[model samples]
Structure formats: C-alpha cells, structure tokens
Target chain A: MTTEMTHTTASEPVTDRPIMTPAVDVYENQDELLIVADLPGVTSDSLSIDLEDDRLTIYGRRKALCSEDTPVLMGGGRAFDFRRVFTVPEAVDAEKITASLEAGVLQLHLPRHERTKPRRISIRTAG
Target chain B: MWMTWNDFDRHFAAIDTLRRELERSVGGTRQSRRLGRWPEATLVDEGERFVFAVDVPGLTQDDLTIDVHNSTLTVAARRVVNPPEGYATHRSERTGFEWKKSFTLPAKIDGERTAANLEEGVLTISLSKLPEAQPRRISIA
Candidate 1:
C-alpha cells in the first residue's frame, strides 16, 4: 500500500481559523479509480480541484453559519476550509478525468491509460 | 487551530454564564469530547429567534430528527454509506456514524413553532422565542 499512496500532511498557513483535512475514500478497479471527499457547507462555486503532474489537490471553503454581531451562545468550532493533497499514479489518463459535486461531496473519476489495461492471450491447437 | 467565538460581551449580558461554557471539543485530544460531539452544532441568538446549524455532509432531512423544548434542542441522525457493487477498495477513510446531540439554548423557546431545514448538507434549525420571553422596545412620549 505504501507504493500506491505517497502523500504528506500540510506544512503551515497563516491563519487563526482551523483548516480541516477532509476525509476521503478511494476505490479502484480494472477500468478506473474513484475518489470521494466530504466537504459540508461548501458550494460548487467555492470548491476547487487542481491537478499538476501527479499531485492532486482539493480545496473548499465553508460558508459562515452565523452572520455578524450575533454571539454564539453554544458554539462548535467550525472549520474554515477543507483541503487535501494526494499523489496519483502516473498511469492515469489525466485528459479523461472527470469530477462532480453534490450535497457537499465531491467525486473524482480517474481512468487509466489504454496501454495499461490488462490483456488476455489465447493460443489455437495445432492439427 | 480551533478558534471559538467569544463574542459574548456584545448584546448578551443576560446570558453571561454561557461564556464559560464554550466548547473546546476540537482535535482528537480528549476521549470524552472526541466521542460525544459528532456533527457539532453552533447555536446563536437572532433577536426574536435562535438559530442552530451543524455540518452534516451527505445527509438529507430524512436522515435527521430534530426536537425543541423549553431551553433544549435535540438532534438525532443516522448516516450510512453503501459501497459499490463490485469495486475493489483501495483506501477507506470516510465512515458512517450514528449520533444524537442535544444543545442548551440561552433563553426559553416556543417548542411548537420550530422550523428546521437541511440544505447543501447543512442542517439549520430555527426556534422562535416565547411571546413573553422576547424583548420589547418602548418609545418615550
């Protein structure tokens, strides 16, 4: 599993609000790889997904629950934003990658290159 | 890191005790807090009403149940994820959780006039203040 995943935690950002590392689920099969991330309160306009070389990054900002002036009587520390970085395999076809967001969950589909797919070999009996 | 809003000195002089009750339930440090406050919520007073909001991504209204009493509000939810039929799992970091959390409001509320909405994975519950509990303005003659 170490060979498949190569990622490091974030270094630093100058801000008082906490930035959360969103939880992600990765699934793979012969055809494609699926990545799902949870980012509540983030709309499509505030969410961004970027891929450069083999590193994939996801970023989203959480909308403020309370407007200003109102004191939070009972408060829970709401995370300011959600961000995560992952190292994707080189065999993936970056051109065919697609993504969709619904109900604050993002799904990314990465299809493998045609040459990397498994092939079957057959031999005919000699008469 | 985790920043809690302590803006209590603004207009909430009556609810001064709530300032000390601020939640430090952040980071995986304490076992009691880490396990208790799932889908943490923030309750605020909005003049005539109280607003409660919580982050519940991938959840709908059908998955949640909200109840409001005199000075307490309860929320119960069940989140379940079904994997793909024939897909191989590479990394599974997201999991489902079942929890019921209750919040204490600063003032008395009208339980019969509560409204709840679930939008874009955020659950917002609005509780109206009782007629006698709301503030009233009187103009000098």
Candidate 2:
C-alpha cells in the first residue's frame, strides 16, 4: 500500500489579532496535492493566499452583516478571521501553485515538480 | 494498493471514535457540541428577531430543511460526500454526516415572518419576535 502523508507540520502563525484556524482536508495524487479549507462567511474579496519560506499560508475574513437595529441576544455567531499555515514538501512545484474559492470553501492545488514524478523503468534483454 | 477517499474516511472515523472515548472518560460527562452531524450553533436575540447561525460546510440550500412548530425552530440536513469517478483518493478528512437540531424560542415569535438564507455553508435563520414580546419604553407622567 502506498502511504500518503498528509500535513507533516501545520502551525497557526500569530496574527495581528487572534484568528480561528479553518478546518482543512488535504489529498494527494501522482500529479498534484489538493488542500480544501472550510471558511464559511468568507468572501473572495477577503480571502488571501501566500507562500513564503516554503510555508503556505491562508487567511480570510468573514464580515458581519449586523445592523444597529439588530442586537445580538445569543452567542455563537460565525464572524471572524481565519488563518492557517502548512509546510510544503520540497518536491512541490511552488511556481505552479493555484487556488480557488467557491461557496466559502477554498481549494488549493499544488502540482508536483517534473523531476519528482514517478516513471516506469524498461528492462533491456541481453544482445 | 491504491488508497481511495472512502478508505481514508474510514481510518479517520476510527481515530475519531477512539478520541471521543478518551475524552468521555477524562472529561467526565461533558457533552459534545455537535448537533446531529452539524457543528456547534449560535442563537442570538436581535431585539426584534432571533438569529440562528449554524456551521455547515460543503452544504447547499437544497440539502437543508427549516421548520417552526409550537414556538420551536428545527433545522435538518445531510451532508453527502461524492468523489469523482476514476480518481484515486490519497487522503480524505471530510466525510458525510446528518445534522438535526431544534431549539425552543425564549419568547413568542411571528412564525409567518421567519426567513432563512444559506451563505458559504453557514445556514442563518431569522425569527421575527411577536409584537407583544418586543420591549416598550414607558413614558413618565
């Protein structure tokens, strides 16, 4: 069985303000890695993805839509910022990283480097 | 062997079950926040309305149901996982679940005025308070 290692090392970097770490699911295949994070209430205009020092960072803010006339009586509202960081493997093709957000979920695609792809070996019969 | 997403989900579910057992033993009768399959929810009394927000990632309006009966609000939904055919899943952490919850309104509300909307997987419900239940300022004689 081929063992696939998910996130080897994940950390929540300190933001200027405290932030919640969005729940994430990671998958990998022969060609690329997929990272999906659930960031409800976050809009595309407020989402940000960055890569620095081999660490992939995701940040987003979900704006609250309350008005002065509306007073919050109960707790547990989901209006806050999201932040998470993951260390990328050396085999990843950082230059080819791509991301998309839909319905409040963010998907990141990281392609494998050409050299890291597996290749089949051919045997030569004795001449 | 190629690992499919279904296999990965089973593995995680096993670990989650074990973890829950440990927590139950150590925490001493603490209740989990999960309501059915949905995450924790918040209920707010917005003076004129009661607002409900439930975290339901990867869900759409078609998957949810909202109803009011006898001053109680009920929300129900199911999250289904369907991976594309032919793609071998290396890992998976998201799984399908059923979410069902009901809450008793603190005060009478106008059921006819209730409204709900789903955005980014968060289901929000607004229950307008009955006119009599609203606070009224008394004028000094």
Candidate 3:
C-alpha cells in the first residue's frame, strides 16, 4: 500500500473563519500520478496549488455571488473556505508537476522521476 | 347607475396593487441561490485528452447532471442528507446545498463531442480537440 502524509495551511490568514475541508483522490499509472480534488465554486483563476520542498499545498476561497438586492427564496448553509496540503513522496518529479481545473474539480499530475520509472531489462539465457 | 368616484378609485387601486406585486415577483431579478461548497477539484491532461475527476464520495451517478453548451460545461447535482428519521442531530458537518459547477473550455478542446463518465463518485470528462484544432503538417512548395 502507498503511504501518504497530509498537511493543511492557508496562504492568506482569515481570523474566525471556518477551515475548508477538501477531499482528494490520488491515482497512479505507469506514466504519471494524478491527484484530483473536489472544490466546488472554485475557478481555475481563483485556485492556487504549490509544491514547495516536498510539501504540496492547495488553497482556494468560495464567495457567494448572490446580492442583497435579490430575494433569496431558499438557501443552504455550507462552509466555503477550504485548504489542504500533502507531503509529496520522493518518487514524484517536482519540476514536471502540472495542474488544471474543470467543472469545479482541480487535477494535479506529478510525473514519476525518470530514474524511478520502471525499466525493462533483457535477460539472455546461457547458451 | 354610475359608481361613485371613490369606489372606482378603490377598484383601480386594487388592480394596480396586484400588478405591482406581480412585477416584483416575476420581474427579471436574479434570486440568490446558495450552493453547497464541496472540496476543490483537479484536472489532469492524459496525452490524448484531458481527464477531469472530482472527489465526491457517497454520491451516485443519478445525483449528478452535466450539461455542455458551446464551450461551457456545467455540472450540477444534489446531495441528499441521509439521516435517521426522528433522530435528533447534535452536530453535522455535511452541508445539504445543491452543487453547481461550470467551466470554460480551452481553445484546444472539441466542445461538440465531449463525453463524460462517472466512477466511484468521481466524474471523468474526456475532452478532445476537433480535427481542425489539432496540428497538421503541410508540405512546403
């Protein structure tokens, strides 16, 4: 089983605000590893994912678009602020890490280090 | 018999009042809709196309609705709160807001033929570029 460590931090501190809880899914394939995060109401421009010295940080804020002038017939109370961090493993290639956003989902791909990638060695039987 | 001016004024005032209320209710005003905030999402590009996956646990495919228009993709869903009936809740972390998400497609995407599939509560959308958007080789004269 692959072991992982997670840490949470906020780039901009907001006092008395509830912490955002983010759910993540990490997938690995022969070529690279993928990290998918579920962050609703977050746009690509508003999201920030950083990898600093083996620690990967994901942060974002969700703001309400509704105005006071408009009447709210119904509403639900939910937490919007979210922040999560993960300690990347040494097998991940930091330089090649890339991320994208679509449908409120953020995906990060961390390519495996060239040296860590599997290499097939040819075996020759003694004749 | 001619109705008194006072009575006619009252009748007309009642109609005007009803019209004002109808206008206020049906006018082009955006009703504030609050969306339940879930976790953030990450998209990964897999050589052929982009794989968009979201971490949504305890949700089934029937709960999600995905719509694509032009270059915009919208994903909306409702997460029903499953609680024991007549059970008093002390504290709850789950927020029962309807989730609504939208994204603008990049130039390298074929908005017409996009496809989406959900697995294990994670939605994967395959976005491929049109033939024209893809790079082609032209011979130099």
Candidate 4:
C-alpha cells in the first residue's frame, strides 16, 4: 500500500510582507483533481499562478479602490494580498494543468498521468 | 519670559484637553462602526459522507482556525487591513468584519477523521460516516 502524508505550515512573518489568506477547496475524481480558491476583491489582471518542479504557487493582489465619497476616519489594512503553495503528486500531468478565475474563485484542474490510469483485466477459464 | 506661571499652566491644559477630546472622538467612531454580517453555510449528505460548504471569501488558512468538539464544528478568522502608501479611498462594499461561524454536526459522522478544504472563497468540509452508520450485509441462510 502506498501511504500519502500531507503537511501544512502556517506562520506570521515579522517583516512588512503582504498577507494573503484565500480559502480553497479540493476534489478528486477517477481521472483528475480539481482545486478551487476564493479570492474576493481580486481581479484577473492581478492574479498569477506558477508551477515549479512539483510545487504550485498562487498569488493575487487587490488594490485599494474605495470611492471619494467614503469617509476616512482611520486607515489600516493590507489592500488584498494572497499566496498559497501546494505540492503536486508525481502522478499529476503537470503539462496539462489549467487554471481560471471567475467571480474571485480560482479553479485548477490537474489531470492524472497516462500510465497511472486504471485498467481492467479479463479472467481466464481453464479446463 | 515675563508671563506668570498660571498662564503657562492654562495654555498647556487647553492643549491637553483638545488632544484628549480628539482621541476620544476617534475611538468612539471606530467602536460604533458596523463590521457587517456573516454569510450562510449549508451541509448535504451524499450517501457516502456529509459535505459542508461555507461562504468565506478572501480568507487565507492562516487567518482561519477550525475546531471540532462534541459534534460541534467552529470556524473563526480575522481579516487584517494594511492600507498602501498614497492610496486614497473610493467605493467600499466588502465587509471588514472578522468571522466566527459554527455548526452542530450529526451523530452519524466520524468526528475524528474529518477533512476540510477551502476553494474559491467556499470552504468545504467532509465528515465520513461512522462504522455504525454504514450499511451492513447479512449472510444468506
């Protein structure tokens, strides 16, 4: 049996780095895996996803765009900064990975490698 | 230099009072401001397991904490705001409210092996059924 272990690390950075906290969903089907991430206030122009080796990274920045009519009693809060990293399994077909964003949710589809697909075997009857 | 000590004390007191009032007004306004409402969540049973979906956009895992105890599940997160330099205010729609939502799970679920994932602002949590909740097959006579 092959055992799979997934580890997640969460921390707070001391430096003046941007903060990104987008929620995500993952689903596995017979042939592929699907990932969805919610990034409200982020536009497509400011979103980016990159894959290197077996790691996938998602980044997005939401610019502050409050209207002139809004009153500014006090100002504080990172406009909108988001970043997430995931380790892809070797069975994933990296070349065919695709991602798209709609209404602030980012969707990613990772197809399984050809060799790892399931195959059926026929039983033989002998006299 | 020729002014009386009483005059100096009065001037300083006036400035101090003004500063105190300014600070009080700022604090009051901030406290009175509304943070906004939380979104609704739904759970459905799909034969094999129970699936829960919550609407919580723009929240990272670091900002969120999930807890399960005695068949109750709670999700809490704080949204931080760090305005940029030279950025001015415009229209505002997104709620700056910190969220803390919870749900009571059914007894049929296996609380120990629950799994959660967040995607596209929707948080989906799955709870597998307990062995007792699963259907059993009886031997034929």
Each predicted model: what fraction of the native A–B Cα contacts (within 8 Å) does it retain?
0.70, 0.47, 0.00, 0.09
Cα lDDT tens digits, model 2, A4-100, are 1123224343644436656566877778888887777787889889899788889888766465446443443535677777889988999999998
Q: Pick the candidate with the highest lDDT.
A: 1
| Angstrom error at residue B104, model 3 | 32
Every model: iRMSD:
4.7, 8.3, 15.6, 19.5
- Cα displacement (angstroms), candidate 4, residue A33, comes to 1.1
- Global lDDT scores for all candidate models: 0.73, 0.68, 0.56, 0.58
- Candidate 2 clashes between residue pairs 3 or more apart in a chain or in different chains: A73-B45, A74-B44, A74-B45
Candidate 4 stretches with Cα past 4 Å from truth are A1-17, A67-77, B1-141
Docking class of 4: incorrect
Error of 2 at A9 (Å): 12
Tell me the spans in candidate 3 whose CA falls farther than 4 Å from its real position: A1-13, A68-79, B1-141
How far residue A121's Cα lies from its native spot in candidate 1, in Å, is: 3.3
Q: Alpha carbon lDDT of residue A52, candidate 2? A: 92
DockQ score for candidate 2: 0.29
The two-chain DockQ for each candidate, comma-separated, is: 0.45, 0.29, 0.03, 0.04
DockQ-derived CAPRI band for the predicted complex in model 1: acceptable
Q: Which ten residues in a row have the lowest lDDT in candidate 1 chain B?
A: B27-36
Top TM-score hit: 1
TM-score of chain B of each: 0.71, 0.69, 0.57, 0.61
Best candidate per DockQ, number? 1
Which candidate would rank higher by lDDT, 1 or 2?
A: 1
Instruction: Kindly list the per-residue Cα lDDT of model 3 for residues B40-76, writing each as its tens digit.
Output: 2434334345445444544567888877665455778
